[model samples]
Target: MVRREHEGSVLEAGQALRRGEVTSVELAERALAVADELGVYITRFPEHALASARRADREFAAGVDRGPLQGIPLGVKDLIAVAEAPTTAQSTVLDWGQGIDAAVTTRVKEAGGVIVGKTSTMEFGCGVPDRAKPFPIPRNPWDTERWAGGSSSGTASGIAAGMFFAGLGSDTAGSIRMPAAFCGVTGLMPTYGRVSGAGCVPLAHTLDRIGPLARTARDCAALLEVIAEVPFVAPEFTGDLTGLRVGVVREHHFPEDADPALAGVFDETLSLAEGLGATLIEVTLPYWKELTTAVLVTASCEALAHHRAELITRWPDFGVSARGIFAAGALVSGADYVQAQRVRQVVRQELARLFDDVDVIASPVASIGAPLLDDVADEAGQQNAEVFEKITTPYWNGVGNPVLAVPMGKTGDGLPLSLQLAGRLFDEATVLRAGDALQAAR
Candidate 1:
């Protein structure tokens, strides 16, 4: 029965607590046990978790309760600091003995949420893992051999594996959504500045947004309200895509070399939308390639500026792959970075015009299902996977638009595939409303 609770949504788990069917301590224990079995947790906070849960139980008994998140167990991404807990960022660069709490941690604690532990993240928010670090690579829950996807790999894996109800994750260039796509969970990369990034380790200062990964879109919406401090209204949208125009960006829909199974999943996902009254239109945006190029150029320059001293002084402390990428930023010229930003402005202007013709843009969240860990071990396979992922994901990063990745279905091998829904800037509510309707139909 406790195992069943692990599979339930946040609402279901909270209900179980309210009804006296389970105590907070028992729930925390079960979450820890599951994490141990699945190898999901990086820093297990057994003592802190139990103390928080005990306080929650006492509050409930005293007729005082917080919000829906009151007693829910959560996984904190290692990128975000949580007072006293060692935040390794899955890199050996930091001395594990030191720790400090960030803004997000304080907010969650104030809301009565119990953070179970910190989950692993790739070194400094890049996708590749560093084995040189003390932490182990995060395995996908659906297929252990496959990559779980991204810098937020462990946070996504932990939530999908039912170690926690929902976990906090950061997205700069699809870090949150990519992992969520591979793990068969829902992830939202909220609008820029919608959620605070005050204490998060930066990958790209202008592009990063902190959001939640959960089993369903409704749960994500609830979490958005808490973190973003905005009221969520259920999108008044209903059945049939007949009048709702969805633009399938001809250039961004799928890569020229997308796997056959992934393409089929994408087509089926479109059909599902078409069946519900969505009209699919093929359109192309001007300078889409320039947008992505600009993002990489600017991000590389910014990252170099942030980590210059650390790279020079403690070079060996970093993982080889992570260091290689971050160090390349050292070569990016200031003139080129400014040129990229200029191109970025032009692209955003073009995207604004494109959106005037359609309500939403549809694309695959990833080019292929999760690949085997062994395939990514060597340099050739690593390069192939990196290029494949950037093809579908980085454009949204370039535009800084609000995008949501929802689990559409699974691949033949049982891994998950997802559809990306992008809305106009700062208009996440509309995208999520559409997601809620589509998720219900599924």
Candidate 2:
């Protein structure tokens, strides 16, 4: 069985600490021991993390409480800056000159969350691993030969492998959800701009978002409470879905080339949700093809605007895969980017009408499990077209809504299958509530 992050979750660890069953130092030590095992972290902060853990112990002993994430070991995706470490972004082009912590990183520290290290990600959170580069190419915990999905590669796999309680990840097009699905963990992609993006490196400025990845949706909720700088209230996971109108969207989630097991596993998950009193209504997304294309067009153009200078001066400094994407942005016409923006507005209105009938939309995060590392990329860092098609996460990013990906079942090969819950604009509370209940039912 795939051991999930929930086995050593934040809630449980907090409870253990309160009961004097474990110390923060012990937790920090345990987190450090395995940090290097899965090639998860790009940078490690041993002395600093240990000192924070000791302070946590002092605070706890003196009856002081920070928040839900207090004393919890957490990972930060390397694309986000940390004053104590370099923000490598898994590439060689950028220089970290006197790194300052990102806004989100500051919030996490304020909540007493221990920063174990900076985890690995796709180059600038955009492409497949470029093995020719000196950075570590993340390997899956489920099957080492298979890849840990990206561009939030190491964060999700590290959570699944229990390297740390949970971590922060960014999503432009399925970076968070795709990796969570492949690695058998829970990842939340909050509505764009829900969390501050002051210091994190951008992939597509128009499409980028930051969110949490953990073993369960409730854990994600707790993390969100801290990171989003929102009001605090732990989401209830009563496994009760009464009066929950779930929009069942199977339009393109189940593809012709999907794994044979996807249909069965997805059906079983829906049945379980229905059993919990969720009224399922069939629905289809509007302009799925147009929106998908829009995302590509918009992302490429925006990314090109950011990297055009460096790309011209030092093309070889970038990974082969990232180079191609940045260069493609140059080919996108101004009209194309504007048209994609127009499409975003129309989809937002259409989804509003759709949301009037359903509380949340449900679908498969992906149709297949993680592909082998050999298939992740070639010498030029090009991924297989068919492999990329399996991910169903980009649509939500384009629509700019809060979505959650949670493990529903396993494939025939024991790789995880995942379910997605998408909610109305800025309605992350409802999305997390539904995700927690569905995960609890499963």
Q: What TM-score does each of the candidates earn?
A: 0.92, 0.97
Q: For model 2, give the 10-residue run with minimal summed lDDT.
A: 1-10
Error of 2 at 401 (Å): 0.5
Q: Model 2, residue 19: displacement in angstroms?
A: 1.3
Per residue, candidate 1 scores C-alpha lDDT tens digits across 1-442 of 0133457888778888899998888888887777354346678788888888888889989988787677788998888888758777777776443356666677777767788998877788874665556777878888787778786887888888888898889987788898899888889898777788867878889777788888877778767767774444435545445677788864655666665677777777778888888888887866867776787777777877887898999998877766776777878887888888788788888889988998888887877787776665457213344444433677777777888899887777767888888889888876786677688787
- RMSD of candidates 1 onward, in order: 2.7, 1.6
| Angstrom error at residue 231, model 2 | 4.6
Candidate 2 local lDDT, 178-252, one digit each (tens): 999999899999988788887889889889998999988989999988888444455666778899999999998
Q: After superposition, how far is residue 219 of candidate 2 from its true place, in Å?
A: 0.5
